[model samples]
Target: MQYINPQLDIEQLGRAFQRDGRLLIRDFFEPAVVEALSRAVDEIDWALTYRDVNGDRVLSGEQLRSLSAEQRAMLVDGINLVASQEFQFSFCTDSLVAAAKRGESHLLARFMRWMADEEFLASIRRITGVTDINRVYAQATMYTRGNFLVVHDDHVDAENRRLAYVINLTRNWRADWGGLLHFTGPQGDVLESYFPHFNSLSLFRVPQQHFVSYVPPFAQGERTAITGWLIAA
Candidate 1:
């Protein structure tokens, strides 16, 4: 969020997204309209979370206890077991679902509004050349030591996701510290990768094979980003 008032050449970005099918725009996406919400990010209540077999969830201790033993075991042990090979993730998150429902006076609500603003959406349309984009969903994600996401293609019927985006906010991250975003090829070869560079915007077409590399225990700082999708709606 460094550039508060700098001009961005949307047409040029659009060309890049067109030619590459994915792009990493350095120091982009700092919307002055959402400056207040960006400032309030430190106050967010983070959920120490993992994606359960059921779906996206954030469980409290009492809530975890309330679940049946079988369910809880599957969500925790079973899912972790899957992580040994298959797709799974563990990280801190604060999905802005509830905040998006509030009035615009709320900082997060205003941020959500800004995301769906015609001016902003227009920029996205120009980039991807997918004019159907109507709205988007966003969540704050933080990867601390040991946090990881195994490879998976983002897809869900009726969601109509056009592309996925991640805006990194962390500073001074080292390359060897891990937590890089990696895209895979058909035979599981790494086609491309991007470190969680501070103040950068990453985008790729939806339903693409991608994963966040595991953060090693020796990682010096948190890997933080605002990630979400631009949807066709």
Candidate 2:
């Protein structure tokens, strides 16, 4: 499916980005494209991983194999050891680039490939004025009840990340349901919060402090999104 933006003007978008350091574009993708992407997300298998309070991955396939039976049980039962911050469930198709190199083809893979296309990158450059962007990185994330990510500036100078993006796919989400993206000021006070609205794209400049609030136990549905960074070559 083709990416369509019927009403957006690149110059206007760039002006807004310069004024605020961030932008929220609703209906960023065509309705049909969003539907297909949402279905693809539902069909993928997600691996659950734990992150410590400092936002470091503490448990995974290899790590689990090294733990004793009792340690494994504690992890499986969701018992927080001294280091854990929260649980994370996600599917990262990091092999898409490699598959493209080998001439592999699939609907989802092709869609992901388009994300790194020069045309797409050029469009982003016009909107954000980040002329150096030459690569795209992405992963699907599912934030179920109790999952969260703490505040941090997504800085990795070596990666040359220019913009962070999230494509929300969860419909009918309420503000009180949690999982909101909260941005903070340099003094640690909340500057703004964005609800996880379906088919909306949220973009922020690099080095911005932000966090995804916890999904509460009483939330009615899962919060799912495709998140990634636009990077320099």
Candidate 3:
């Protein structure tokens, strides 16, 4: 499953990403896979209201601090529990690792095969130059909609987390339609942006400040993507 595709010309992509801390490979996903993912997301319940730190709906309040004491308790509990939202999808960061750690191999085994498949993983390795990934240290991504992740560096505590990878599942996305990911340089300077268009797979270094802009309400539809950390062993 870890075999390399000789025709991919990975060294060039690897060098570019190393120099700039980011790389975008256009048309990385096959049309059929993209369509299947798009349909999967469409089946989820979409939400305009989101629960905040307080148990109340953030969309219904003027500020997060405005919630009552009872609401605040609900918010605290929810913080530890992640639920699917119409606009975002996030899973427990350690789900895959925990399964592997307990000697349960099915989830991770399926994932390893998925990553190595030409329809999936080969292109990623060609661009990322990652080798001998540690199965116990990785996790699955929560693929959801309009999830605008704010600017921040990747987890500072994950020792092996050197890069972030995103496989675009968005179709017909446009620059003006928004949901653009902004990458900042080491000095807090704006580096570049990539729109969530079809077949766009992006990889970037971990320490960079990056944020995703909100998907405009007027856009034809919400955007989606599969994201995971590429860690060192």
Candidate 4:
């Protein structure tokens, strides 16, 4: 499915980014493309993992199986712990094109390739006003009950990341169910919050304080999204 938005207003998008260092584009992907991407996300296998207080993956898959039931329960209920299901993929500058050349046919891989395409990168550059992007690091994240990420600035000098993007795939999310993307000011107060609206795209300048609020225990559905960073060459 083609995901490009030919009618995107580059000037307006740039102005929004310039104003707040962030922009939320509603109905960013076409309905058909969003449907296809959502189905593809549902079909993938995700690893159950635990993230530490620093938001780093601490335990995953078989490692969790090693823990006793009581220990596992304690870890899940502990403060500063984040439990989630996710799959991450990284593409070098030319890996996407190389994968296509080798006849790679996975739906999610193809979607990533589309995102890594020069045309798509150019479009993102126009929107964010970051022109050095040459690599795309993408992940499929699933946040269920009790999952959360603490506030942090995504700053890794080696990655040279310019923009952070999250393409929300879940629908019918409620404010009470949580999983909102909250951005905080310098004083640690919430400056803005965004829902995981279906087919919407959220982009922000890197090294900004932000986080995904915890998914409430009563949330009946999973909060899923394709999230990634656009990095310089």
- TM-score of decoy 1: 0.83
Tens digit of per-residue lDDT, candidate 2, span 2-30 = 68567777788889988998988788888
Angstrom error of the Cα, residue 117, model 1: value is 1.5
| TM-scores for every predicted model | 0.83, 0.82, 0.61, 0.83
> lDDT (CA) for every model shown?
0.77, 0.75, 0.55, 0.75
**Candidate 4 displacement at residue 201 in angstroms:** 0.6
Question: For model 4, how does the per-residue alpha-carbon lDDT over 106-162 read when each residue is reduced to its tens digit?
Answer: 777787878888877888888887888988877777787777776777888677988
lDDT value for model 4 = 0.75
Off by over 4 Å in 4: 52-55, 58-71, 77-104
Instruction: Report each candidate's C-alpha RMSD, comma-separated, in the order given.
Output: 4.1, 4.2, 8.2, 5.4
| Clash statistics: count for each candidate | 0, 0, 3, 0
* Candidate topping lDDT: 1
Worst 10 residues of 3 by lDDT: 85-94
Q: Give the lDDT of residue 168 in candidate 3.
A: 68
Writing each residue's lDDT as its tens digit, candidate 1 over 1-233 gives: 34333577778888988997899887675556334444565566667677655665576545656789788556657557768755678877776655777554666666666777787677777778988989889888888877788898899897999899987877788878888999999999999999877667898998899999888879988888788999986
lDDT of 3 by residue, 67-143 (tens): 78897567545632543332222221223444444666453434444553454444555566655333223343322
Residue 96: error of model 1 in Å?
A: 1.8
Superposition TM-score, candidate 2 onto the true structure = 0.82
Residue-level error in angstroms, candidate 2, position 34: 0.8
